[model samples]
Target: MTMFRTLYGMLALCTLLLAPRTLPAQAAESLRTAEGTQRALPRAPRLPRTAFLENRTLVAAQLSPAGDAVAYLREKKDSRGLWLLPAGGGNARMLVGSTQADQLMWSRDGRWLFLRASRVLSIVGVDGRTGVRVPLGGTERRRVMKLDTSQPAAVLLGERVRAGTGERWRIVRMDARGQRTLLREDAHWIHDVALDAQGRIVALARFEGDHDALYRVRPDGTLREVLRLRPMDRLDLLGMQADGSLLMAGNPGGNFRRVMRLDANDRLQTLHQDPRGEADLDEVVIDPRTQQPLAASYRSTVAATYGIGDAQAVVADIARKLPDRDIGLQAGSGPYARWLVSERAPTLRDPRWYLYDPRNGNLRRILDDPGITANAPKEATLAPKIAIDYTASDGMRVHGFLLLPPGVDPARAPLVAQVHGGPINHFRAGYDGIAQFLANRGYVVFQSNFRGSTGHGRSYTFASNGDYGNGRVQQDIVEGVRWLLAQGIGDADRVGIVGHSFGGYSTLLGLTFQPELFKVGVAGAPPADLGWSMRWLVEAGDQGDLPDRSLRHTLQALSLDATDRATYTRLHAQSPLVNAGKLQRPLVIIAGGADRTVAIREVIHYTATLKALGRPLTLLVEPGGAHSPVDPIPREAYIFAMETMLQRHLGSPAPEPPGQRLRAYLRENLRLAGPEFAEFSSHQRRNPLLTDNSDAQE
Candidate 1:
């Protein structure tokens, strides 16, 4: 009997030992099957996230003017350096491996490469024979652009700083002998400086009051304005003609950009224009081999996708000459000769090298990154477009991009009017997932290029100059939503609003001041009170109190300020946190703990106000994130939290991830006792047994 009992115990122990290992395998198998089933479920089609994910890392690509060799800045987390690769396509080798090394450039001859590391600039021989620092001879503040060995001279441009009422900039020249010469000086910045074929120092560009103008400089420090701009005209000096005329691009008379030539006689000749005129003058180049206009590339705003039509036509005409050639736009090159003029092709890393044969318009597509072509997403689940116009508070015609759901009929889509952050920024038409992601689950996304937004004229861009966190900016967003439902594309009943940074402040103001519009609200890194933000602005380099900081002084002069401190306090009371009790919809707030710009403490105070109001809200704090949660991990966390909250309020489909238990735990337990939950709860409260019944009942 004793032996039999001992055998039974041993068998029980063996079963215990085997069960744990086998259970995981069973669970993993079940998980695989469940995931497969979930994926196979009949659902709206979406492209693999690989399309956006692959290009997430942006390296500074430097290319030779001839497009034969390339160098780029590569960063793997904290580690960063320059990597060199053949322009025609080959293995990339690390030229400089130190983290601080960046700003790689090729000399005019393309025989050598230069990189800036801290205070020192290192030069590399293309043949891998010599590497040394070229001694800088100009003032400490002056910087040089290294040219080719054939030219053997570098152009030095100085920093422009406004002193008192005058602007001061120093332009200098340097040679291989490490000798410096003060070539020219200007109060305004010299925008474009290039060595002509005759080795003449030409100052073809200058920045004046938010406008660029073409200028010429004699070898002596004398400046001559070659072409003056109209109040609305912006000059982008393309390059020099072989005969010494300047090639410039800008919309001189219309809304769209057009290429034009400023001849020796100062005649502006129009080159080409698309009907939609919203074409972006990407870059311009003349063919050194042929001494003719090589090619010009432009990106169309999503609102006016008609620009792509011209691009397609131009490429089709080119393709007729070279049969079976797919073309892409080369991103970066020099003044003469573009790399690619092919239509619908992905832009090369350095877009400037794009060369189109002006004689025949034949595109040269070299250095094809097949990985991009092979993995490029072809799915049509891009951001939707709704061209709507709204009368701003000032009665200006404000055009905005209203993105609706991918598959939903326009009539059934919910609204999520997302205000872009840069009050100075504009949202162009493009394939953006954030808009599509909101839309995919069923929500109409509205992105506006409000009054402060650019791509409009300078007058429109600086309209909201001193009006940060004021009513004018907030009204633009409010009026945008009213225009949407007015168009009957959005369901006014189910509307949510969201924004980030400055946009985040607008989102909060949209809810607090105009509570009836948005049914649900989210503000990422928003500044709550204007007074605190004003103080923050002062502390964070607003320079309003300082005398020498003229830009800040100029900006301060442009803003709408209270006549007195008392009036400013009245403005503060109108803030989102001042009236948190008015929030009718669920609110979600996200803040980065390490945020330096928009203080995380401001968000915390805002959330605290909402919490005090007894309103349901979710607060997410990214640990190592900053005011800009540009990092992938934290951004994903913020996006997930936001989507989950928005889905909860607006009834949109949730993304597949974050298992049910985890989601539930976040919703139930991490509601507000974030990070400090364990410390905050007592023994009885911490015990799941005690709380389980009460939580279930509640």
Candidate 2:
């Protein structure tokens, strides 16, 4: 998974799905949810509730340019501190107190760390005594193009400058010695940049609305268009190869992205395309020193970057040594050099950093970030996530994960198929908070990367062809659940579905279309009608969350065309709101009143219609909650309400009675409690903060 999706789960989903699996009950102040649950399934859970919600170590390790010392960041006293770990295993010392560091890179001579916090870039001395702030020039934002660590101690930057009548990007070079030089400028918005070994700009990718183009910078100061992609296609320039050709990964005229080399003559040469032709060129790790790619892999957690040139052999060796492990490349001084690597071993369950010495072909475990490792449940208490794939009804292969309930038999335990947010994003075999929490709750958890999910390739992501409502996308999820059931992985009569955003919509679709298959559902911020949602996305203009026209292009590329009458009708006919009366199974929808993604008005309308039709539906409308409801009270309510809903319908663990804070908030926000929320509504209303008081408002 990408960092953006990881952050979305943390901030937006809050601690709702990320309910920590605690140790005993040191901090189990449950929403009457993850923390304070007091019930047993076949038996009490081995790992407490808070274990899954534990925070990760907010630290990163970087191999210094000399490759003899490792510079790492650690969270200390609410601020970040820079520390140096000796490569030869000696005492690590704090170099300085760095507050709120967003991005950082070591200068060539290892004398300073150029750290960027927001718009200000400061070069802090490694000696802990000197600090120099690099002044910036631009309209409002000055983004770092590349941390040019080659020579002359300079950094490449892109400044959005005001042109004659519009805005353009002015690429400039800023040195540690307090000097700046204008390299070149571009008319379109620059998204990707690459530099040659000598620190000269080789090629860059720019975007104008949905159209993207990659240009090669000539020595005479002119840009020659090398490759251009249509709105429906994708393209990315990785780096400059040692032979001066630009290494790129894109789906120029095809559905799947492949690794290629664009020479000085603009001729394209295929490097590696998935030999099986089933997966995309997922992620590329570039060498900072040479700006050339080290490796590429299809899975988000790549076992290794084993598809480049010289760096391929080194990574392939590492892969051979650590087979079945997610060996992701972290940092290295130059190409074919010592690397700071991150390995996600099954035993660890979480990624651990290591210093890999290519000379000796050995990996030495280094100091970890320690946030999750220090607080996670013991290995015996937790079960490993098993990666599995099965063929769908259409004969196309589908991949997913299964996290069986600790100590619960697959044939006897309840099943909860948890869906991911982006219909395009896929689940990797690693730490998944929602699946872990649900499995800990004594339910067999299933997460499937349906047909439209990414990672497989461009064709895989767009395969559903805007059929999210009831087509292959929906069938993929249902087929996965059925496949697991046939394997005796879950109790047939006690299966439920849950998710957020698009996953939320999938949950709704599962209950409406597969009522007998899914006994209950819990949806968060679900857009009741996919057709309306797509139209609203394109017609409402840009929300400024992403680049201009990025969202529109994504919708268009996915085949969701609001202008097409037939396409809109098909999406509308399959939508849950259009067929709400078919949903006889129990469902509890937790919605954010302030959610712009799924308008609160539509949710209210759907709930009101369900109430009129006497459907078993409950709605919790959080007035202050945004799309993800990061707030503590609202997030707690989501898990608590869903837990209660499932417990009532699927015979899962019964939630503990509500606390004062939760009761007050629920009493006010439970717009329609049907049968699922009747237990929570019966909680005593004698709390002091039951009114429009501080606790209730929170």
Candidate 3:
């Protein structure tokens, strides 16, 4: 907290702490012009850099419960608000001043739209009324448990409030009419809830410090424990089945989630597990009328939805009607029930919604958001992604998605391995802007859901336990690329890596440990040393008691123990920064100057060390950004830098030059620029540490 430490702590990172410099007017004007000097490569489709950088929600619409209208949350720049409209696309009943909300759900009665913006919950009447707003306490966390359309306009809300030293869950009911009722309050956190057809709480699953339990809500309003699981096991109360049993998803550690039935006598029966036994059962579709899981989704090589009981035929019917697109079904109210079907494809930037009457097999397209479609790249100009799987070096099977540029020969395309951020997330079937942008430039994009990634069953996720920093997990990615290369999917010699956060760390590892394989790396807010980052997280990252997902416990299970000295030693030995001398490939690091997760100081120290070693590296800092820069200026600058480096190394497409504002940003915030970025900026300042004639080394 002292000024002395704040200013001088990172002073050693550079030989000189030069004052900020503004770009010359001439340099700025030059940058405002299109295209860079390196136009020797194949010309790619010209799209605005903003096309790849826009993260704003274009629009989200949900089919009304009555299946006669659609509720729209429009976020177009000029039209930023909520609106209610008819199913046939008539006039909109706009709700003024309600521009942003975190999540959206329709009220049960189809008269309102439930919106949550941080701690505040608001409901907008479809009649264009001002609506009712309810705010929670400042320091509380809430999860919307359920919104059953068969009932009234009430919601089952789980509010987590600070209790003495720990936190407790207060389950409450809030309706569109502004009525609030306390259903039940418990000491542990309520993770899931199941309600009956009449809007009554059937059961609730709570996760405590060392164990989890499912409690049945008795008729007298008391709670009875029906099922309990010890630490590391999973328990989720999906809903109440028709046979008076509690439908659930649970796993006894090891990551393999299974669907089961817990009868009134507390007898458990296995219903459905991933058929391949390698993917977790996610995306449970609940019946609005019966309040039970009708279908569930799992991801292996690709994502697939398996229906439960009578729902299997309905899902099959939808598949026959709508082929080649991922189907996301949201239940709606009607005679035979209408399904709000969202059709998603690899090239479709936005999910195309359809009103499907399962009874008569009737389907109709409903959404046409101009905010996205107006700026979205042409469908024919975009690439297509396919689910792929390959065997790794250790004989374990790995699955991922690959995006190929349209009209480009797979045998000749350059390769870019796009690693995902969460060591918990995976590359799935979707329209990814980054992958599409890369593919649009004629690079064969490979994203491997390496070991330690979720979506695949628990065993695969737990397979990388203690293997982090040891090359097993990284090998999965490398092996996948090698397999693809063998299939003539990409050029073996022309390969680069890019990612953010953990994926960023993987990018650095590829450049450092496998420099001969990967020619360049672009890391966004990378944690240079995994062990150090974990240690910092353990000490300073958590606000209160560590949650299950905090990596306090999961880190030890997935990789190394954060508090163990031996674990730190092993992790540091394999970390990129500690092995910076091994990195011979070009690297461009884009960092948030004030990143709390991966401290900016860590990035500075790593780049400084590389500079001392005379390594070819560049550092781009977004001073006002955290973790990653969401603002267009810094983001475009990053894309430009990455494209330039890749173009220079791999013969990829040339990038459009940074715009006027981005040029100024580069001149000021590009703390370190190398020869790769020489064309974009007049100021190419290499550290004195990089030259042998210079006196300063450290």
Candidate 2: lDDT over CA atoms? 0.69
Error of 2 at 669 (Å): 5.6
Identify the candidate with maximal TM-score.
Answer: 3
Model 3 local distance difference test score: 0.70
Kindly list the per-residue Cα lDDT of model 2 for residues 1-698, writing each as its tens digit.
52111100111111111122222232122211221121222443445334555343445667777677887767765678777888877978988675556567877777777777665777767677556675453354577766665554667777877777877777788887657888777777777777777677778788867677788888876888877877646667677777778778887767677777787777887777766465676667766666666677665323234647787667887777766666677546664457877765333445677788878888888775364257755545554555555667666767666666545667788999999887768887666656666766788888887878877776677677777778788888888788667655689999999999898899989999999899999999887888777676566623322442367666667777654677678888898988988989888888887777766666666666676678887788888677887655676677778778888888865776777898899988887777666765674343221122332100
Candidate 3 has a TM-score of 0.85
| Model 1 vs truth, CA RMSD | 16.2
TM-score of each: 0.67, 0.81, 0.85
**Cα error, candidate 2, residue 583 (Å):** 2.4
Candidate 2 displacement at residue 5 in angstroms: 23
Count the clashes in each prediction. Answer: 22, 15, 3
Cα lDDT, model 1, residue 583: 69
lDDT of each: 0.54, 0.69, 0.70
Best-to-worst TM-score order: 3, 2, 1
Query: Where is model 1 poorest over a 10-residue stretch in terms of lDDT?
Result: 1-10
